[model samples]
Target: MKRLSFFVLSIVFGTLGLSFVSWSCNKKETNTIVSRELSSKKTYLYEDVPFDSTKVASFFVKYPKLLTFQKSIVALYKNRQYHYAWFDKKGVNEAAEMLYNKMSTVQEEGIQKNFPYKTDLDVIFQNSKTYLSPNLDAELLLSSLYFFYAKNVLTGVDEEATKKIGWYLPRKKLSYVSYLDSIIAKPELLAKDDKVVLGQYYKLKEILKKYRLSEQKGGWNPIRVAPDFKSIKPGDSSQTVSDIRTRLFATNDIASDNKSKVYDTDLVKGVVKYKKRNGFKEDEVITQKHIDEMNVPVGERIKTIIVNMERCRWISEEFLQDSEYIVVNIPSFKLTYVKNNRPEFKCNVVVGAMMTKTVIFSGKMSYIVFSPYWNLPTSIINKDVKPGMKKNKNYLVQHNMEWNNGNVRQKPGPNNSLGRVKFIFPNSNNIYLHDTPSKSLFNEESRAFSHGCIRVGKPKELAYAILKDDKNWPTDKIDAAMNKTVETTYSLKRKIPVIIGYFTAWVDDEGTINFYKDIYERDNRLSSILVEEE
Candidate 1:
């Protein structure tokens, strides 16, 4: 790798905006002869030349608008050892053309940022002969353009912007320098699915297209019904039933649209499916609430899907590389344990309420504590314990709480706030997954009643799964540990990655779109930012 001697930002060219003519025909003729000779000898595609760093610095100085990508372009040249990546002996490489097309249609990729140098780039692409000679300006411009596209489409909004909107998840880190090296080696990769972005992003993009098409078709009509209608059950006949059938068919919740006026078995099945997808109870009964949800404008749903797509952009492809991981989606109120890239099991979970919203982040679950004590936070103690103790003098004894080192802590028992076990992943947020004493809360469709930590609905099953590989802790031993009065901690031999995320819209494995209420009103905040920018 050759290093550039000249500072890219130091030199200034006054005629940068003026378009330069293509290289002379004599130079093209000389390159043509050299190209034929190399092809006839069956040697390398293009001969490597010593890259002049001074020329690259001069190119950047000419187009100061592209100075933001100067460092990335320098790294790219170093990786390629000063070789021309976008140009071969014959002409401009296919990868450069594909990249230009991708950048031109970035809006189709859900990017809102306008490219400042797009007009200059268009001039370069339109002139076929400009790439015949080793043009440093064109080469560096395309390299900078690649980085720009990678940052906007593959990476996402900046970290500072996401933090301003309350997203605390670790942003995905990628080296565009190395990525460009790989692309230069194999130009065909540009046309293939690179798997650079999250798989969910492409899925949501497809759904977004479908939704926008629906919106263009004037969207679906709002279901009309009398105010007195509290709920509609199976076997009921009304005009609202026909409207519901049409709405379900439009959304592909049902296979065919019979336009039936009666709430028959098909309609009941569709309603149940729709309910389950929307985080509602899987029941045959349809209430006014369901009708209201269906009445929401299609444009609004499209916006929600787009907002969630932006969230997906923040996730890295490295997450899919892990063989075993746990994902807890806050809005969905569900915990999924995936093994071998397949979901092993999913269980209901209770997340933090709006006032005490759960933090979005990732951690390594390295320990599980059985028969755990509920070490109440100071806020909880001052807010709830003191108030209760004022009313009932025996509050501490009745709740099995004791004063420990001048702080209140609940003893391990069936009635303990942290039921019988807790999964620990140390972080500054002081959040962990634990079992709750109130089991009935899991039965409810919406379970956001916790402080900041997550509550597992099936804690015993989770314990068994986490320790199933360890012969020392069998199923019976696990149960015994949970039932014991003494708190026992087990260090996991293999730490699983746990990711807590917030997505109000998700596509399931069956291609069904699931929508949930923005429990913390995050979607609106993000949507407002995106709209304001637009």
Candidate 2:
């Protein structure tokens, strides 16, 4: 009787232990959804902290107290993301979780004590990585709680982090922050900024409680992906001219020239201001040429957008350390080399025509020259010169072009075609940029007007930049170098990589994905292969 009773007790205890294990497992998950109070778990976004350039580094480092409120933030700081790092799905999930947890731990009170007065998102996006440096500020240790980790893996810290704080609770509900708007056409809460945020932007935040742009189930939105690059095919006369132009000069950067586009004198000039701003001919007429420009295929435009987008993506910038860098928007027919974050030097460039469109690539600024000489490309000689020589026999002499394949070479002269000066960034394409003799084309907008090269808007400034690095080779000497065949290379202390790119749609400085007319129209053909159309 004793043995049977003991066995019964053992069985009962074992069942109780199993029940306890299951209860604990279920409780943790339930706690995540129901137990946490929204008001008790307060959070902040980028606006809570305003920028103060003086206190950068100290604000970005990790603190022992931060670990007390947050465990995830500590794990994130420990992760190392060096180049050539491979990321699998597991890594991505963990990183995202860590981010969500860290953002939740940050409190408004903590930000007030730690950061400079009224810090915002810009300070974190532009300067947080530098704040992580050892040379960081002492004030940051006491006050600043902002820091960047894993390079560009973190960008919208202040604003983005604040939104993430909501994840610990239920996701489908709603947010007071307008940027966190869900299906509702309006945001729960918002700060009045005139730019487009995540969703539900209110125009006059004061007049109305909120205004929202409802999410559409499906319709004609993706049309902007490669937008109709060409007009609705040729000979389709039913379409209004304005409709065609509306899609053509839709870029926010450009405006239509003459609003009164009647089919006479005014129409003859065709979209003047838009054409002019884009470095195209200011003729406002919607002529056959204009139609052809509008008719460029969608496939080519997609290629342009993809290539240029790649260029922007490749730019892993930590901060705008240097105020400016030379930017050559290949498809746009313009060049602006900025300084101190402003366009100090801008020039009209003659880029490659469709047939010999310049390859999208990049290199660095080595130096600029005062007087630069031109070494004509061999391809030009073969394609342009040899054909002309066949007709004129004295073709080489007329253009001052000489050819003796055996131990002799063509020398430079007035008709050499390489113009007075050129910018050099040596690459595999055998394409060294130079000035051109056809200066009038600079006035045209659709400047797909070169034999696969780039022409600068301001040639003189480029000349100054090239030679400025060489102390002995003063600006005056640059002009002298041009007349003489003195081919010299001015190496840089650090050669910055130059990226020659082609993009049709890009987010501007204000973070808006501004679209352009895909001159080449190649996106659809490529995108079809890469993405499913449904």
Model 2 global lDDT (CA atoms, 0 to 1): 0.37
Q: List, residue by residue over 1-534, the lDDT tens digit for candidate 1.
A: 121111110010000000000000000011000111122332222456546876888887688877888888888777556777777876677778889987777766666676677887798789878667666667777888888877767766777888887777767676777666556556655544324555666666778888888988999999999879999999999999999999999999889998889999888889988987787888999899899999989989988887887887776555545667777888878786765554555678888876777788788899999998777777778888899999999999999998889889888899988889999877777788888889999898778787788889899999888787799999999999998888999999988888788888777545567788877887888887777755
- TM-score (C-alpha) between model 1 and the true structure: 0.86
Candidates in order, TM-scores: namely 0.86, 0.46
Q: Write the per-residue lDDT of candidate 2 for residues 1-534, one digit (tens) a residue.
A: 011121221121111110000000000111111212233432322213323443332333444333322332222222211111111222212222233334333321011122222234234334534333222222222122223211111212222232232111111211112122110112211122112121111111111111111112111112121234443332233334544444443433234533222333332333453343333455544444555544544434334333332222222221112333454556555565544344445566677766666655445556543234343445556666667878998866665545555221334433334555656566655454666567777776567666666765456567676445667667777666656554444555544334344444443323233234445544444344223311
lDDT of 1: 0.74
Which candidate wins on TM-score? Answer: 1
Off by over 4 Å in 1: 1-52, 55-64, 126-130, 191-195, 384-393, 531-534
Model 2 TM-score, all chains together: 0.46
- 10 residues in a row with least lDDT, candidate 1: 17-26
